[model samples]
Target: MFPIWIHTKEEVKRLLILGAGGFGHMIQETARLLGYEEVVFLDDAVKGADVIGKCCDYKAFLNEYDTAVAALGDSGMRLYWTEKLMEAGYQVPAIIHPSAVVSPSAVIGNGSFIMQSAIVNTNTVVEHGVLVNSGAVVDHDSRVGCGAHIGLGSVVKANCVIPSRKKVEEGEVIFSTRRKIDGVTSRNLEDALYAFGFGLQCSYVKPFGEGHINETYAVYMPTEEGDEFAYILQRVNNNVFKDPAGVMENIFGVTEYLRNVIREEGGDPDRETLSCIKTKNGCTYFEDNEGQPWRCYNYISNSVCYQLVEDPEQFYQSGNSFGHFLKQLGNYPASSLKETIPDFHNTVKRFENLEKALKRDIKNRAITCRPEIAFALDRKQDCKVLVEQQENGTLPLRVTHNDTKLNNILFDAETGKGLCIIDLDTIMPGLAANDFGDSIRFGAATAEEDERDLDKMHFDISLYELYVKGYLEATKDVLTPEEVESLPWGARLMTFECGIRFLTDYLEGDTYFKTAYPEHNLVRARTQFRLVDEMEQQFAKMQEIVREYA
Candidate 1:
């Protein structure tokens, strides 16, 4: 027999609720209001007035009660009980409150609950075991999948498909027409998409980019002809970035400024810089239910990001791109930018952090890599080179991208030139040398950051010369002579600083950087130290290359 809708007590004599908890009690009260003469609960724990037997013994009372409701808080449990009771020849009817405004045209499946003042609009299909809670709205033509719970006051907008067993949180506006993508949908990601107002029919949503600091997703929304990547959503790593709001502020400010500058220079502002997509309430970032900060930006259509430098031209383009970026933002008030990460590029402070980590030896790992530790300790004075120069006014502070690795620069797919410098999370007031140094530290490397063999990782001076040529060619007119000369030191100290950071994270149990293995950070430290050693040996040649370009 098909499941029925319980509108009045005349249609059902006695109502049996499976759970005897608060929700079960609520269902009992609602059933009574609908004119059910008797309401009894079968619970394993609660034993009181009107309680009949344990939940597992429902089959024994099959003849006594003709109508039943799960009344369980968990959707899975509710569905399981509802199906089990239906198979036992019981009428599992939908128990909707009288105040709810459910359209006659809407299909309310059996075993669902339309609670107080809830509105299920026309043509909406609320599947079995669903709960449209108090003041919730399943707008026109939307489908609330089986066993889904529409939380109190949440709004499921028109034509949206809420997947099965998904819980729409209280007050959340579900704007997307969701289709299940493998390894894509989460409560946090869904809320983040809703917050950013991306509610069109989603083709797919998948994790994008190789950034270690933030969780990034590429959201594709269907258009007239086909599916297109519409936006880039990122969950900012609050652990690494202590002040997310401050970070967003810096990003917003810098990007807005870049937009204006790009427009003035007859450049496509959208392609040249990232355009931050504000939340529905116009906030720069949306804090999810878990207090994690999420932000979205328009996806640059014809751009590509590289994880490693494949060719000499790519490295040159990376240098040119970053150089041009610095030149473009040269006039902006650098001091106004918030230090999203305080002492981010402070080599001295980084070295101190390593010292602390070594002393603590939280993981008792210092014994495994004595050579790495000693390498860092011997170059203690090297860490202070850039910091001292900056403090004494020899190096001027500029708006620096703290992480200027080759991958951070997005190249144009058509031209194979650097299109945009993405990943602006670390934009802060810092020295020009640090920025120059960071790019050199990564782009001009002979091997991967985590290369195990020390012999394989050498400082590629030829690649370094190409980058220096590209960088100085772009910014020779804008940068100070002091900044130009400090570029070599930037390369050296930055490499050394990176080694120090890896060692620190290693000693502290590899908490900072993501590691594939227990000794991964140590391997990375060794690679950096190898590069630093080569850079130090070729220090004169590196300086000459900078001077040659300058």
Candidate 2:
């Protein structure tokens, strides 16, 4: 592998490319045209380091060979060879194909390779051990980290950071060194696109569908060292809810507090990551683009943290992962880091929305949903009880992960243990019961929330147990007695909350939620309501289990 702007002291020299791939051919021709007859190609199984008359496979013979290029157009491949050759005390050369165009101001470090037809635009930095493969374009002001490889035909937009040691394979990622201006953002992370000021990049490889909101894409920005980060970029789908940022802010507040609290308790400090992104001068985050809010985010590499729990004992011994997570949040001394989330799990707010929805319906019934559903919602005096309590200031509130699903709970790929908690878009101040119950509710459901078959839609106790054991192992020690007691009820409440939202979307014609079938939202709503009913039947058993486990 050769560096993109390498400093070659003396003239005519021999270079070797180690693969017979398309990139290897480009290197062979480019080397010759540039007045050097020292170009040789070698593939993985090539016998004597020589092949006669094959345009690229020549210029070498016998056991005597020169330094080689790891040619298959991926950084991981290059990293592997670079390590082997370095360990063998052989020279691992960095070379740039003649046809590739690079900016005058761009910086290229040692031991990196640039393939043919790749364009590195103005002010971009291609660091040490980086791979700028064929047809890839690094736009102006971008940063390509050390040992990172930009795959064939991929595009890294202006001012973005390509995290070190990460591989961006076959796609255009629109990330920036600058943040988006406020106002519009999409929770939809389909790949790096301009949405509500938030950058949501997704990784279409391996785990295809993981997130609950927005689309996702893999992204690695410049700034990291030999570390290959598998990041994600996604957009915010604010049209799904009336107040998108408000919901995000609420979730963000609680998680930030939990991170701080955990640190105070001498637990894992990396679990809590809340970043404040600011947009560029012309980049507005609140703009409506194609009926969705514009937003963007930096997706960290999962390989960097393949699991959520590193050790179950540590989950308990680390001063109680959950307890520490909550306990030390009050210790972070930074004033700007602390914030609040409004209307988190407040049933009263739902009632208020129900009332407003009813008044609006009274004026324009055509704009309303089913009369029965709307009327029932309008007449929901039960939620008013919770609202009055909220007003009376008797409701319990704390930091919470609103979308507390297991997939959201990242587990280590290597050890199958827990690591840090990620996906903080929905951290907010809510009842601890809501967090615990929601974790179980989503993890244990027999079928997917939007699965078409109603019969398949039931809770799986085994799966629920797996999730509960993990959650309990993480939070048992720090949980308040009220938090523990309210857990079963919390699950019921969250189930109902989800059911209400699903039904609301279904009645509203399915515009808010993405669906595979026409009545998918309705099906989901029914499933949740069914689960709620089931939970009601098992209320006693659920409480018993909680007591047994807690």
Candidate 3:
């Protein structure tokens, strides 16, 4: 015998929720707030006044209820039960929490639930059985597919479309298919423009760049004088970089020095080096409400950044560009720059960390990877060569771009000449050889860094020769006789160090780098080791090539 009940909304008076989980209970309260007086649940585990017994009795209770809503969190289960309940002659109304701000033009499908503080903006579509979770925002013209979840605090930027059953993780911002951003808002971005001293009429602000380390945005500021300019905005990844202030100091110092050098050479300073924008407070960086640090740079027009080695000539040009960067910074005070990441390229310290991780064996993941462990452990003594040299004062510490990958250099779009070197995150006191070796390690490979097939992963000697030629051409006069001799060793040691790092991260449960699967880091470690082995076999030839260029 059911108690007499009166509902403010006649359509949802006999509402039945099909699950009694956390989401189910939340939905029950949401139903009450929406004027449903007779809310009931059907769960196998919980006992309540309105439970109406287990889900087994759902078929019998269908005739007693006017409408039903799925409170299950799992997309597949929600979608399955949603179709089944509707097939059984019950209406499935979409439930929107009273606090949610939904657009009048948005199309919300049946059985979807919009949670508190979430926004479904204009012309967006929330498909059936989807959950727009708390504090999530689906911006204008977006599509939340059937059974998909817009996770807590996640932002789906405008014109983006998420597919069915896709899960957008908490606080993750999906900019588009090609990029992901985080912790930025349009209001903050606009404020940053004025803060950075840009007073032009702004046209648009959108997420930009294909960089893995920083969250980037392209800000378009159009002037009334018919001049439109774009600026590159970025949020520094404090996780990878410990000291944002120190990093900015290094960048400002280097760019200021480079500007003076370019002026002497009768070259364009803005195109040759990154020009950092100062905030209204006269600082190089801005701090948002979340403590995330953002900085802006002048966008180099008519420039192209390539990800792959489309041409060997382009790779050589990349080498020359980076070489020029080293040459320009040769006179800068090496002691002035702070080590943004301490022991960053310290192979010996890295080996010690690996050994410590191996001893802890916290994740118990060691049992599955004995071969990779032995591969790293066997080369333990090989790691000390560079460290011992640096300590003995045999190898001079010079300012170097620690990340010497090809894409970090931008090329002139029309001329195809390497125009500038960007991404100065790890510019600190380090070996010139490390920079050269990192470039060879990344660019001279026959296959990708994580290629599964070992047979396809040999080092390309011709590409190595080209890069060495270009790099040596720029710095042959500046590098010391001892620094010249250490070039080959840099290639071998950096590759080995990278392999060891990857294997350690794998053994420690894939903590550092993003892994698509459990064995991804292992695969990467193997590829690096393979390249190291090849470099070892061709060690004498590599030295001859460097000497020839020198």
Candidate 4:
């Protein structure tokens, strides 16, 4: 449990961590693992949210503390506690969980908390009070402004700067934006805006917790005192639309539906909260300045919420609710399941791609795979990990959770019952096994996945049991026996699936998973491959356990 948080608290000359969420706990444990042994967790919460893992607190503990990690799940929540701790003058330590694999050359500042599995690569400079959260990777040479909370599992590739107190959240990637101004690329507006006024406070409290993205800002047509409220600055990137047009389109559609639904259900149509203001087509969604794609969606104050939810956990449930909502749109008949790739299990394609890429000298292949360069397998294994599954008719295509982890499941904050899943961008026609297996891998591991003492870390069968019970409880009626039977295999298969990905990356010269060290991806592959071996050894027993649960 996050009892480790006791260590981050400032009241004690040592540390006192507060939360027990896996990310929080990892930070606590990481401090100890990284040689900060005086750490203690002050984990006393009103509910089970306080008892993530083994941590439990009887009576509510007081903040006779200063300088907390502010490692709470929500970026907004982190800011809340951080303000409290700072007001009390408790020195919030800038902690990179010992296992985060930060580049030695990287500079981390005070009050920063780098949670588990984060990868901060070479020359990346992090200012004070940054939150480099779980599974989030800041690629080579990135800069994070003060109090920027990088969210769970998000990817920030290459070079970029996250502004002060901004929260760049889960599952998104950021890259620098440069528009060729007069053939001389001008400074990007979004980047310039984010870098504006270092004292800006952006994160605001939300019903479910705190809002994640700080991609916009609210301002008037020039105030006497420059007074303003919080706003989100839409992220501008090459792969993703900088002008939030695509984003606005889909969101507008969803919210419009929500509004109509509320009105038809006899709810206050006047209560409809959001106002779509047209500011120079590009000002809000599509505009061309700097020749760079820049767009934004400023929050209209005190309108109506498009979606309704009770708490933070409910916020994540939007993913599942979206699924059901999609089903309701029966106007479009559900298409048959089909893999994007034929015989989707085919790993052989990996080799083909790798071979061809090398032949074509794609990007960094030459530098990463040069005979002069050094890495195991000479970086050829990236594509070599694929398999050639026999043609087996067309495989069914169904929406899937490409990245499955516990927090990804939107649980009822009150009941702790998982209501829906979130972060569906990677959804594709894939096997249920992927999601089911990943859920197990994420939660059941004894030591954090990034843990150094490999021996102390392994899958926790009890957690695995709980995951299966809960997962099956929700999905059993619709899942087939074969699918259920394959649950154990699912874990191993997913491990191999990831091992292949890691290995594939290894062959590709470590381009996919950001590495903090020379052999970071290799180490990741070893960890996953070892887990796969462990899964294989216990395959029969695991299957039996699944059978019992089923």
Best candidate (score: lDDT): 1
Q: Could you give candidate 2's per-residue lDDT for residues 155-186 as a string of tens digits?
A: 99886888878888877665665444222233
Stretches of candidate 1 off by over 4 Å are 1-182
Q: Give me the displacement of residue 258 in model 3, in angstroms.
A: 0.5
Give per-residue CA lDDT, model 4, range 1-550, as digits (tens): 0011212323234465656666667676766765654555544452343232222321233344333555565555555565555555566667766557688778776657877788998988877657888789998767887668888899887667787778786788887633222211223443434343211222221122222222223432234565344333333342323334444543444445545754665654333323333343234443435543433334433322212233333323332333333332222222332222233333345435545545555445345534322232343343222121113422222344445655544444444434433332233345555567766665565554445566865765656666666566555665567667756766766665555555556556665555566655545655665576677677777888778867
In candidate 1, what are the lDDT values of residues 269-331, reduced to their tens digit?
Answer: 999999998998989999988888999999999788877789899999988989999999999
Where does the lowest 10-residue lDDT sum fall in candidate 4?
A: 1-10
TM-score ranking from best candidate downward:
1, 3, 2, 4
How do all models score by TM-score? Answer: 0.71, 0.52, 0.64, 0.42
Q: Which parts of model 3 are misplaced by more than 4 Å?
A: 1-201, 223-229, 515-518
Candidate 3: the clashing residue pairs are none
Error of 2 at 549 (Å): 3.6
Q: What is the C-alpha RMSD of each candidate to the true structure, in Å?
A: 11.4, 14.0, 17.2, 27.1
Question: lDDT score, residue 58, model 1?
Answer: 90
Candidate 3 lDDT for residue 159: 60
Q: What is the lDDT of residue 213 in candidate 1?
A: 70
* Residue 34's lDDT in candidate 4: 56
